[model samples]
Target: MAAAAAPKSNAPHIPVLLRPLIAAVAPVQGVWLDGTLGAGGYARALLDAGADQVIGVDRDPLAHDMAQGWGAEYGDRLRLVLGNFAQMDDYATDLDGVVLDLGVSSMQLDLAERGFSFMKDGPLDMRMSQEGPSAADLVNTAEESDLADILYLYGEERASRRIARAIVKARTEAPIETTLHLAGLIERCLPRSKPGQAHAATRSFQAIRIAVNDEYGALIAGLEAAERALKEGGQLAVVTFHSIEDRIVKRFLTARSGGGGTGSRHAPEITREEPQFTLKSRKAIGPDDEELAVNPRARSARLRVATRTDAPAGQSERSALGVPMLKGAK
Candidate 1:
């Protein structure tokens, strides 16, 4: 089903690495996929860069609506799907190239009602798809130990136990329903510190959001699906924000590109399966100073690209990409 319409707002979503991302993906007059069509930014860029057609997938209905608006302008050049990129294989048939711009979008974060940001005073709802259980449910209902584990594992928060204990104690007296309340509680749990690094509640909020949305799970499935969907010689470009996400991309690309240490020459030439992809760039691409200056969010972003190789004869095409191994596969 088509996504509902987005509310009219003038806030501009600056696309990160517009030139480099377009150049790396190289969508040239063929079917291209924007796996995380956050603001329709990359899809619009792909169309402008001479792509014949683009398929945009987003879990957020708002993103699909934004794409629909762009579709009206582009006229048959775009298709917006109300689904997650993890299902790309189900939706994108005979894809030429795919770009997965991972992480939360500025649009969602900026909207107070979306509850993606602690800075905003809204309900504790961080689900990207808007259909899943809200962050409030997780925080209010989960056991203190489970909550602590979520914060520690996903947020990397060192004081997860203290924070979770505080949350459970607070919720017993009153449900932690608002973003600001939770943010305040987390802040209280943390020791006061210098400014500018990040908010005290940042990690805890991130952990909750990740847990509510199962973001890491979706990411692993999405990357595997994108790899399976691409045609031989087709490229895959991924932009990740957090270390957890970036590490997954790094390992996936490394495994497919055969970057694991090869054994010594003395050992018999161990011929594992042929590499599935050749590295497009030697190292991960970060946003340039210019892009970073304009968009502070670009600071944490990392881009990696690879080109698919021809499958061995008589082997299933899907097998060419190798087993879909993720760091924290669900």
Candidate 2:
């Protein structure tokens, strides 16, 4: 196979924490699976770093279409799969390693038609797979209470009730059909963002997108699938772009690594099971000043790595992972 070239400036999106992630798992050999595969930054980096084969998985068909231009250079060494990473193990098992970058891809957010960014004006469709229920369907049909729960639980938006009330009242007059319309409604409910703060609609958009994609559920499931698929000693590295996701990954690793803290005084301590992973770092790794200077989107990125243990893989309790649940969530 031909060697993959260095990423150019015109790339769709820069993969966050790539250098640190690859460096932490150097001597990158064997078949590795990249669960996100958006922008192909990590996949190309893995190929360049010396992976014999990279199974690039993405739920978005756009990712596969974009890869066709340059992916052929690597020939059989690069394989692109279209599907959610939650079922990653179904594609390959006993894998050498796995990499999952959580949250919306920069490419998806860049295209206004995809409806991921509040800054854009497009259809209110935030479906990563381009199939199934869209953000519009949820926003226009969901109950006000459900919307509030989604905003508060998923996005941590403190004024969730106010936003939900506004959405319900506006939808009564007309269906919320576009990104900007929903964003405009949300913006009216909140104070103008200070210069350094995020946009007024950022949190609401995030919550809706998460609901539309079931990202949190898929995240925990994908992590478990990676555990089941990885061979003993195989590395699993996950790059998360938000605090909630980082917390879920941290809690999952802590429990799986047998590092879950002792139970409180009232509750009897349960015996620790055989650890499924050995944490590569006790704390989450963040981008340094140099990376922040280069990619502002990487400012909130966090990378966590662990090596699979010989113990049998098992499902983790959803409540333990800190993933918030909601109905009619979008």
Candidate 3:
């Protein structure tokens, strides 16, 4: 597959933690999977790194369109799928390696109509799939208590009750249908900061987007699917941009690494299982100063990787692990 010309954008979509990810996954000539094909950044990299073929999965139709332009250069080596990565098992067959870069892309946040940002004015829509109920629907229609819980749990906002009360009060008069209106409401409820602090709307917007997109839930399901899909000795590398998402990935990798858990010690050791995946690094990797200077978005990024142990191929089963059935359409 030949490389294509870079997209005509002010800043190119630079895949985060590229060096560490490539080193850990060690992509070879095989069927590779890019679970979150945002702007086709990592997908292009994998092909360039000598991957024989790649299956790129994304929920956004616009992403599929952009990938089509890229596929023209790769010829039959690229297969683009318009769907969520959470159901990766449904599409992936004979996978060698998988890479998942979670959270919203810079392109989505910059696009006003996508409604992923609190910095810019746009509609209240925050559906990553562009088909589900938006942030506006959740804020306007959900009960006050439920809304408060979502902000508190997903957003980690200390003044969740106050924010929920403010939202309910404003929506009673008129629907909170725009990004700026909601950001303004959140800012009003927050106490004035001393100095050198971010806007109060940052956390609220993050929380609402998480709730609207079911991001945490999707991450859990996607990880389980990736685990099940990998062949023994295959690798899974994930890059997360938020603390909440990182925590989930950390816990999952830790559990799989046999770092102590509540399971019976007498029963078969978890690490001895057929589909075991060993941690490639003790701690999550972060970008160096050079990358951070060029792309500020790299600051919050964290990468975790694991390699599938050498066990009998095609003998692993998800039923043995009893992974929870995921909610929502993939």
Which one is best on lDDT? 2
Q: In every candidate, how many clashes are there?
A: 0, 0, 0
Error of 1 at 291 (Å): 1.0
lDDT of each: 0.81, 0.89, 0.80
- Name the lDDT value of residue 87 in candidate 3: 93
Cα lDDT tens digits, model 2, 1-330, are 111232343867878999999999898999999999988999999999999999999988878877887798999999999999999999999898999988877778888888888888999999988889999999999888999999999899999999999999999899999999999999999999989999999888999998889898899889999999999989999999888999999999998998766557887767666999999989899999999999999999999999999999987766777778676323
Q: How many angstroms is residue 278 displaced in model 3 relative to the true structure, after the best TM-score fit?
A: 0.8
Q: Kindly indicate the candidate among 2 and 3 with the higher TM-score.
A: 2
Task: Provide TM-scores for the models.
Answer: 0.89, 0.94, 0.88
lDDT per residue, candidate 1, 274-324, as tens digits? 777788987889998888887898998889988887753122223223332
Better model by TM-score: candidate 1 vs candidate 2: 2
Candidate 3 lDDT by residue in tens digits, 79-122: 99989898998998558888999988877887777788888889
| Model 3 Cα shift for residue 53 (angstroms) | 0.7
Per-residue lDDT for 258 in model 2?
87
Over the full model, what C-alpha lDDT does candidate 1 score relative to the true structure? 0.81
